[model samples]
Target: MAFVGREQELAELAEALQRAAEGEMGRVVLAGSAGIGISSLLDELESRLADVPGIIVARGHATEPRSALPYAVLAEALGDALASLTDEPFKAVVGSAAHDLAALLPAISPRLDALGIGREAPALEAAEQIGSRVAESLRGTLE
Candidate 1:
């Protein structure tokens, strides 16, 4: 369906995309009740940005069963990117930090190992430490 009547929302999304294209961090969140047009808006956004260079649009869905998993959606969204890090250049860019992600994202373990990155000792003492490690590892992956 043709998009209609979301001028303000589209404008905001465009500005955010432009900033990201210029190497600035941009984030957007769309929240609403079911059946509201969130999906449609995202589809429109994807179509609009189809030709923008160096812009990757990764998407992930949170299902009922996986919703309880920590960083489930994040792991899904970054799955392809992480998989691509198996090559030497990308692995070097990620460095040993990629191994830390294995604790949270099992799918990355083999790639991390191939890079000769060893895992850090598990942070069993506190939940906060685990969360911090996960966040740091994710940041490293994104960088």
Candidate 2:
């Protein structure tokens, strides 16, 4: 309801939610300065999607000037995915590497550390590779 000027963002979010309902993992990365209305857009989309099936919404906030750590934002998003997918005991694999996965993706590393994943392993390049592998795995599950 806080969205007053985000028609484009709303459309994109609705599209992603539709994809998710069709058994796909839809990801949207919204980046902008503080107080830009990202949260408002997300809220509006959820309201519009109230009856949509199989689409789960998870949110995390990354403070400005803290986007350097690898996979910080991604980790939060993935954590949401894993948690939702883990209703079945057999789906524990979805979250098996969560801890280590946080180490990958340097762009969000500083943010990840702030979220309590302050590990130094896997390094940056290696972390990226690992993150890609995990993304592929997640896609496989959604497929």
Candidate 3:
């Protein structure tokens, strides 16, 4: 189906992106009842942002055989983009919690290793437990 009018939605997203670029933080959730072409809208928005600088677009899609958690769908979608997230100028942005992140995302282990970090990265209390340190690590990386 052809991508039709959603100029207002697109503009809102664009404005949000601009605000983020100017160092304003915000969370975006595009949602509605099923079969409302959310995927196409996201694709279009992503395409529009393809050339925008200081922007890192990570997409999360919800599809069949979904998870029980309400946010799991989007989380699952964004999870796949984790590698890309870590691959960005991570070393440059990450701060004191480098080892914590190394534990969280092993893909970054080698980079951390080269920097002489995480040789003895602290062990998480549990794999399922994500402490505030890791969250701050990510905020720093994304900022």
Candidate 4:
């Protein structure tokens, strides 16, 4: 589909991608009423960045059915990307925090073990601690 207008939004996305390539964190948020081309803008961005090196893109949506799941949107978006990481790089990026993340994101568990991160079960009583660790690990991975 031809993406019409939104030149300014596309330019901002391009600039954010450039900064991210330069080792800086970049973020873009789209907000609008339904059917206003937010998804179209994202689709356009994805197409434009399809061949960009050293960047990973994942997409997810939240709906009423999955709203009860903690970090459901985040997990859906990042699970595959995180799972694709090889043992060495995964360990380098996630380090000791993999254990906690594994609890939250089971898709990454195999990679965690491949990195020699122990597979100890997180105690049920430690939900808060585990959540904090997972968030920190995710931040480190994105940086």
Candidate 1 Cα deviation (angstroms), residue 80: 4.7
| Candidate 1 lDDT over residue span 46-105, tens digit each | 898778764555555654557568788777767755554437755665665665567667
Ranking by TM-score: 4, 1, 3, 2
Off by over 4 Å in 3: 61-82, 85-88, 114-130
Which stretches of model 4 miss by more than 4 angstroms? 31-34, 65-67, 84-88, 114-116, 120-128
Candidate scoring better on TM-score of 1 and 4: 4
lDDT of each: 0.70, 0.57, 0.63, 0.71
Return the TM-score for candidate 2, rounded to 2 decimals. Answer: 0.56
Better of 1 and 3 by TM-score: 1
User: Number of backbone collisions per candidate, in order?
Assistant: 0, 8, 0, 0
Best by TM-score: 4
| Model 1 segments more than 4 A misplaced | 63-67, 80-94, 110-127
lDDT of 1 at 24: 81
Question: Clashing pairs in model 2?
Answer: 69-107, 69-108, 69-109, 69-110, 70-105, 70-106, 70-108, 70-109
**Where does candidate 1 clash, by residue pair?**
none
Question: In model 2, which range of ten residues has the least summed lDDT?
Answer: 89-98
- Model 3 clash tally, residue pairs: 0
| C-alpha positional error of residue 36 in candidate 3 after TM-score superposition, expressed in Å | 2.2
Candidate 4 local lDDT, 12-49, one digit each (tens): 88888888778888556576677888888888887887
Candidates 2 and 3: which is better by lDDT? 3
